[model samples]
Target: MKKFLSALFSLCLVFALVACGSSGGGEASGGESEETFLSIGTGGTGGAWYAIMSAAGAALNSDLNLDVQATGGSIENMKLVTNQSADLGFASPDTAYFAYEGGREFDNANPDLRVVMAGNMMYEYIIVRADSDIHEMEDINGKTVSIGAPGSATDIVGNEVLSSLGVEPAETINLAHSEAATALQEGTVDVMMALSGVPFTAATELSTVEDVRFIPLNQNEIDTVVENNQYWSGGELPAETYEGQNQPIPGINVGSLVIADESASEDDIYNLLNTLLVENHDEWEKGHNLASDFTIEMMETYVENGVVLLPFHPGAEKFFEEQGVTLNK
Candidate 1:
C-alpha cells in the first residue's frame, strides 16, 4: 500500500509539471504574435504630406493587414518615432539628418534615427506680394517674412534656407502657412517662405491673390547653398503649377523619407516597403500625383541622389538587396 501511494504521488507531480510547461509555451507563443498597429506622423489637414500619408496608411491597413494611424506633422512625427511613441513617420532628409546628427531640433534627442525609404521631393518656395519690393532672397533680410509655423518641417527648412542666405529669424515673422497666407493677403506680412510639395495649397492660394508672386532663388545661389549644406538640393518650381506665372522658379528640393524606429523589426520594415512598392502602387497613385513619382526607377534615383544623408535601416538595406540593388552605403 505504501509503494502504490508513493507511485500515485509521483504521477500527480508529473501531470502538474506538464500542465505548467504547456501554459508557458502558450504564453511564449502569444508574446511572439505580430504587431498589428502602426502610426504615421504627417502634417496639417490641407498639406500634401498629410493627405498622401493618410491615404497610404489606409491602403496599407486594408491590403497589408496593418492598422495605420496618421497623426500630426513632421516635428511631431520625428518626436513620436524617436520617443518610440509611434511606429513610423514622414521626415525630410534635412530633418532626418538633423535628428541623427543632433542638430538644431534634435539637440536633446536620445535615440538616433535613420531613414527607411525616400518617398517624395518637396520644394521650398518663398511667396511674397507681387508688388512687394522683395524681388531677391537677400531682400528678405530685416523684413517680415513668415518662416513657417512652429513645430513644422517647413519651419526647420525655412530657417535653414534663410540661414543659408545669411538672414536671421529675429528679422522674420514666424507664422504658420495658413496664417502667412492670411497675413500676406491682409498686407500685414511682407513675405512668406514655405517649404512644401509642388503645387502647394498655401502657395497656390497666395498666388491667386492679385498682388502675390513667387520669389525665385538664383540657381547658382541655390547650388552654392546646397553645396555648403548637404541637406538642400537644387530643384525647379514649374511656373505652370502656380497662377499667373510663366517661368520656372529655381528652388531647393528636400526629400521626404519614410522613417521608422530601430525597435521596428526587420520583417515589419520589409513588409511595409514591399506593400508600398508592390502591392498598393495603383491604390497610392489614385490618391496623389506624388504617388505617381514613386517607381522602382525613382527609388533607385533616390538612393543615388547623394543627399539622403542618413543611414538606411538594416531592413531597408535588406529590401534593396532583395531587389538585386546595392545601397550607396
Candidate 2:
C-alpha cells in the first residue's frame, strides 16, 4: 500500500509540470500567434507625415498593432528610433543622412538606423502676407519668421536656406505648421518658413481666410540650396495651387523617408510592407491625399534619382527585391 501511494504522488507531480509548461510556454511552443506591437513617430497632426502614418497604422491594424505618435518631426523622429522609443518613424532624406553620419547636430553616429521606405517629396514654402513688403527672399532680413517646429526638418533646412541666401531674420520662432499659419494670419509673424508636400494643409486652410503668396526662390537660389546635396531637389508649385497666386512658385525640395530600427525582425517588416503596399493598397492609398505617393514605384524612383540617401533595412530590401526593385545600398 505504501509503494502504490508513493507512485501515485510521483505521477501527479509529472502531470502538474506538463500542464505548467503548456500554459506558460510562448508562441513557439504553445501554438499561439505572436502579436507584434509597434509605435510610429510622426510629425505634427496637421502635417503630411502624421496623416500618412496614421493612415498606415489604421490599415495595418488587422495584421499588427501600431501606434502613431505625433512628434516634433525629422530630428525628434531620428532620436526616437535610435533610442528604441519608436519602432518606426519618418524623416527627411537629408535628416536621415545627417543622423546616420552624426553630422553636427547629432552627438554621436547611429549605426542602427535603417531606411524602411521612401515617402513624399517635401517642398519648401516661404510664405508671407500677400501685401507685406517681403516680396523676395532677400527682404526677410530683420523680419520675424516662423522657422517651422523646433527639431523638425523645416527648422533645420529653413536655417540652412536662410544662411545660404544671406537672409537674417530679426527673430526666429518655432511653431507647428498650423500654428505658424495662424500666427501669419494674425500678423504676429512676418513670414512662415515651411517644408512640406504640395498644397500644405495649413497653408491651404490659411489661404481660404487670408491673402498669402509663396516666395519664389529664383533658379540661382534653388541651385545654391541644392548644390553638393544629392538629397535636395527643385520643386515648383504650379499656378492656382493656392488662391491669389497667379504664377508658379519654384523652391528647393527634398525627399522624405520611412525609417525603422535595425534590430526589428526582417520577416516582420517584410510582412508589414507586403500587407500595407500590396494587400491593402487601395485602402491605404485612400487614407490621405499624400498616401497615394507611398508606392513601391516612388521608392524605386527615389533610389534612381539619388533622393533616398540611407541604407535599406534588411527586411525592406527583401520586400522591395521581391517586387523587382533594386535598392542601391
Candidate 3:
C-alpha cells in the first residue's frame, strides 16, 4: 500500500510540471505576436514628406502588415515619438537634436528619443518677386515674409536663419507652403522662405510666377550659420528643379530623418527600417521625386553627417550589421 501511494504522488508531480511548461510556452508565443499598425507623422497634405510617408505607409501596411498613419509635421511628430504617442514619424535633424538634448522646443519634454533612419536634405530656398529689389538675404529686412506655419519645422529653421542674419521682426507671416505661394503670387507677401526637399510644389509654383526670383545665400553666411548651429549644412537647389530657373540657388540644407523612442522593441524597428531601406525602395522612389533621394549610401552619409542625435535602437543596429555596415557610436 505504501509503495502504491508513493507512485501516485510522483505521477501527480510530473503532471503539474508539464502543465506549467505548457502555460509558459503559450505566454511566450503571445508576447512574440506581430505588431500590425504604425503611424508616420508628416507635414501638410501637399508637402514632400507627406507624399513620401503616405506611399511608404501604404507599402508597409500591405507588405509588412503595418498600418502607417500620417499625422502633423516634424515638431509634433518628434513629440509623438518621444512620448510614445506614435510608433514612427519624421523630423528634421535640427529638431531631432534639440529634442534629444532637451533644447529649444523640447526643453520641457523628455529627451530619450532615438533615430531610426535618415530621409533627405531639405534645402532652404528664399524666393522673391523678380522685379523686386530683394537681391540678397538682407534685402527683406522690413518686408512681409511667409516664414511657414506655426510649430512646423520650416518655421523653426526659418526663424533661426532670419535671426542669425539679424533680420528681426520681418513682418513674418504664418502660412502653409501652398498658402504662402498664393500670397507671393498675389503680392500679399514680398518674400517667402521655404525649406523643403527638391521639386517642392510651392517652390515650383513660385518659379512659374512671371516675376519671382530665387535669392542665394552667400557662402560666407552659410558657413557662419553652420558654425553657430551644427545642424545646418551648405547645399544648393539645382536650377533644373524649377522650370526656367536656370541657375543653382545657394542655401542652407537641413536633413529630414525618421525617429522613434528607445522603448520600441528591436523587432519593430528592424521591420520598419527594413521596409524603408530594402523591400519598399523601388516602390517609394516611384511615388515621389523626393523618394529618389532615399538610398543606402545616403543613409550612411546621413549618420556620418552627425544628423543622428539619439542612440540607435539595437534592432536597427543589428539590421545594419546583417547588411555588413557598421554604425558609429
Candidate 4:
C-alpha cells in the first residue's frame, strides 16, 4: 500500500509540472512566444561602438521586454556573433565582408552573416603633438609611432594607409587607442593612428593637454588609397574637432554595418530593430553623438558609400521594404 501511494504521488507531481508549464509558456499563454534573451557585441570600453550599442541594448531591453547584453568590439564582436555567443554585432563593413568571403584576416567564410543597420564613422588620423616637427605623412618615416592594437579596425586601416604611403616608421608600437594617446602625450610615441567618429574621447583629451595635429592626406593621397581600395570615402575633418584646430583636414572616412546572426528568429529581429528606431530613438541618443545619424537612409545608401558589401537580414529587409526603402538585396 505504501509503495502504491508513492507511485501515485510521483504521477501527480509530473502532472502538476506539465500543468504549470501549459499555463505559463509554449503557446499556452495567449499563443504568445516566450521572451528571448539576446547579446550584442560592441567595441572596447570608452569607444564609440560600445557607447552607442550599450545604449541601444538598454532601450530594447526595457521597451521590448528582452534580455540584452553588450560586450567586446569590432573583430571580437564579429567572432561573438559568428560563434552564437552574441546575437548581434557592430563592425566595419570591410571586416564583416572579409569574414563572409574568407579573405584578409579570416580563413573561413561566414555566409550566414547579414546586416541589420549601417551607421556612421569617420576617418581618424595619425596624431602628433602640434609643437613637434612631424608635419606630414612622410615626416614620420624615422620616428617612433604606435599603430593600433592587433585585430582592431584601426590596425587594419592604418596599416594599409601607411603601406600605400610608403611609410616605414623607425619603430612600430602596437597600442590600444587610449594607451597610444597617453604615450603620445608623454612623448614616448611620436604618432598614433585613430579611426573612429570625430572628437574621439582619447584624442580630444590628448588635445586638451597638448595641441594635437592630425596628419592630413591630400586629394592625390586620398585618390591613391581609394584607387585600389574602395572601402573608404574621401572626406575632410571639420573644424573644431580638436583643440586649436580651426580648419578642415583631408582624410578618409568609412562607416560601420551593424549585423546579426542568421539563427535569430525574424520576429525577434524585426521587433528589436523596430524598437530601436521607432520607439527608443531619443533614449538611444543618450549613448553617443552618432546615435542621431542612425537612419534608414544610411542603410539604403551604404553601397554608394562602400560601407556595405553584404546583404541585409530578411527581417531587416522586410522592415525597410515596408517603408518604401528598397535595399540592394
Candidate 5:
C-alpha cells in the first residue's frame, strides 16, 4: 500500500511537471532578459539539496542568461530528467548508478542519463542506543532496524552497506530520517542508519532525547566494506557532531552528483557546466558549504573503478577534456 502511494505520488509529480514544461515561456526575473530555459530537479523544499540547487538555479538565471526551475529532489529529479521533463538533477552517484543500470528500483535503464559535477556526503552513520549491546557495525545483525525511507539516498546506501557487511536484521523498518529517529526513541526499531553531513540533525536530536551511542566500523571492517564498494571511502565523522559523541565515528564518504538528460542540447549542457564549474563556483559556495570542496581533481577522483553510473554528456566531457582531464566509464 505504501509502495503504491509512493508511486502514485511520483506519477502525480511527473504529470504536474509535464504541464509546467508545456506552458513554457518561463524567463529570468525581468522581462528584459531572453534566457536559455532549463530546470534542475532537487529534493524537497527545505533540505540541503533543495536549498543549494535552488540557489544554483537562481544564479544561473541571473548570470548565465539561463532560466532555471528548481523542482523536487533526487528521485523526482531522476524521473523528470530521464523523461526530459527536467534538464538536470542531483542524486547520489551510487543511487544514480542503480537508476541507470536497472539494478535497484528502476524497471528500465535511463540511457539518457549523464553526470556533471560531484560532491561528498560527509559521512555514513549507524546509530544504536547507548546502553544497547550493539557497539560495532557487525553488532547490528539480528537486530530490528530502520534503514531510512524507501527510495531515499539513505535507504539505498543503507541496504548496500548492510549487504556488504553481510548483516541483516531480524526485521526492518522504512521511514524518513526524522521518523526513523522517532521510531527508534519509541522503541519501534533498534538501530538507525543515515548517510548525511556530520551532526545529522535527526540523529543528534535522538541523542539529546535518548541515551544513544553511535556504532563504528573498525578499520578492518571499513577495509572489507570498501573492498566491495569503490564508491565508499573510509572516513571520520568528527567528534561532537552530537552530544556524548566525543570520538569520531568511523563511516564512509560518498559522492552526490549533478546529472543531465541527453535531450538537453550539447551546447546548453556545455554552457551550464562551464558557468557552474568554473565561473560561478564562488557564488554556489555562498549558499552550499559542499560547493567549497568541489574541485576538478575531486571530480576526477569521485568516479569509481572505471564504472560510471551515468555517462558524461558530450558537453561536460568537452569541458573537462579541455581542462586536460578525461572521465571514463
Candidate 6:
C-alpha cells in the first residue's frame, strides 16, 4: 500500500510540473516568442514619411509588434507623441523645435519629446505649370496656391516663407498632398507647394502627365529665411530629380526627425534601430527612394550642421555611440 501511494504521488508531481511548463512560462513554444509592442505616427498617406515609416513597421514586425498611423503632417505627429497616444512619430526640425520649446503652434511646450533619429530632408517644392507666367517667387503673389494640409508644418512654414518674402497669394487653399496635386493637374489651383522628400509621390505623378516646373527661390531670400529660422537651410533639388525638371531648383530644406516620448525603454528603441537600419535595410530601401538617404552618415550631417532640434532618446544615443557618433543630447 505504501509503495502504491508513493508511486501515485510521484505521477501527480510530474503532471503538475508539465502543466506549469505549458501554462504560464514565457519560453517560446511553437516558434512564437514574446514581442515588444510599439506605435509610430507619420504624415499623410501620400507623403514620403508615411511610406518610409510603414515600411519600417513591417520590417520590424518579426522582432517587435508595431502599429503605424497616418496622421496630419509634422505638427500633429508631434502632438500625438507628446500626448502618449503614439510611441514615436515623424516631424520636421522646425516643428519639433517649436513643439519642444512651446512657441508657434503649440499651446504648451512639451519637454518630453526626444529624437530617435534624424531622417531625410523635407525639401520645399513650390510647383507650378511649365507654361505658367509665374517664373519666380515674386510671381506667386496674387495667384492661387495650395499651401498644404491645414495646421501642418508645410502650412506654417509655407506661410512664413511667403510672408517674409512679401509674396501673398490672392487665394490660399489648404489640401492634402494628393488632393493638391490633383487640383493642380485639373487647373483648379495655380501653384502647389510640397514639403517632402525626393521622388514625392504626388509630385512624381503630377510631373509624369503634366508639363511642370518648380518655382525657384532666390538664393539670397532663402539665405535670409535660413538666418532667421535656425532650422531652415538653403537646399536645391538636383536636375532630373523629376522627369521634367532640367535645372536644379533652389528651395528651403528642413531635417525630418523621428521623435519619441521620454518613457520608452532604451532596449526596445535600440532593437528597433538595429532592425530597421541594419537587419532589414534592403527592405527599407524598397519602401522609397528616400530610404537610401536615411543613414548614420546623414544623421551625422544633421548633427554637424546643428539641425538636430531635440535631445536624443537614450536608446538611439546608445546605438549611435556604438557607431562612433556622439549626439548633441
Q: Which lDDT tens digits does candidate 1 get at residues 40-114?
A: 776655466766766676667442444344444577788888888887778777677667777677767544576
Error in Å for residue 284 of model 6:
1.5
Highest TM-score: which candidate? 6
Q: Which lDDT tens digits does candidate 3 get at residues 1-329?
A: 99999999999999998777656532433355334566667776646787777667665634354444445468888888877778777888877777778768876655567777778778887888788888998888888999887778889888888888887655999888888888988889998777788877777766776557888989888987788878778899887778667889888988888877878778878887788778877777777767767666776787777666677777777887787665777
- Would you list the rank order by lDDT, best first? 2, 6, 4, 3, 1, 5
lDDT of all predictions: 0.73, 0.86, 0.77, 0.77, 0.72, 0.85
Higher-scoring candidate on lDDT, 4 or 5: 4
Candidate 5 stretches with Cα past 4 Å from truth are 1-31, 35-37, 44-48, 55-77, 199-201, 204-211, 303-309
Q: What is the per-residue lDDT of model 2 for residues 232-308, given as tens digits with 9 covering 90 to 100? A: 88888879988898898888877899899899889778978888888887888777667778889999998888876
TM-score, model 1 to reference: 0.80
Candidate 1 RMSD computed on C-alpha atoms after optimal superposition onto the true structure: 5.3
Residue pairs with colliding backbones in model 4 are 42-72, 42-73, 43-73
Q: For residues 1-329, what per-residue lDDT tens digits would candidate 5 score against the true structure?
A: 99999999999999998777555465433434345767776643323555566556655645354334434335656877788877777788766877687766778887778887775464677888777889877788899988765666777778888898889788878777777788878888889887766544577678898988878887887887789887677898888878888888787876678788766778787887777778887887776665665667667776534535578888888888887676784
Segments in model 2 whose C-alpha atoms lie over 4 Å from true places: 1-34
Ranking by TM-score: 6, 2, 4, 3, 1, 5
lDDT of 2: 0.86
Give candidate 6 regions above 4 Å deviation. Answer: 1-31
Error of 4 at 85 (Å): 2.1
Instruction: Please identify model 3 stretches exceeding 4 Å from their true place.
Output: 1-35, 61-72, 209-211
lDDT of 5 at 117: 72
TM-score of each: 0.80, 0.89, 0.83, 0.88, 0.76, 0.90
Candidate 1: residue pairs that collide: 42-73, 130-211
lDDT of 4 by residue, 129-225 (tens): 8888988888989999877766777877888888888988999887877788889988999998877777567777778888788889988888888
- For model 5, the run of ten residues with the poorest summed lDDT: 63-72
Who is ahead in TM-score, 1 or 6?
A: 6
Q: Please list all clashing residue pairs in model 5, or write none if there are none.
A: 42-72, 42-73, 43-73, 306-329
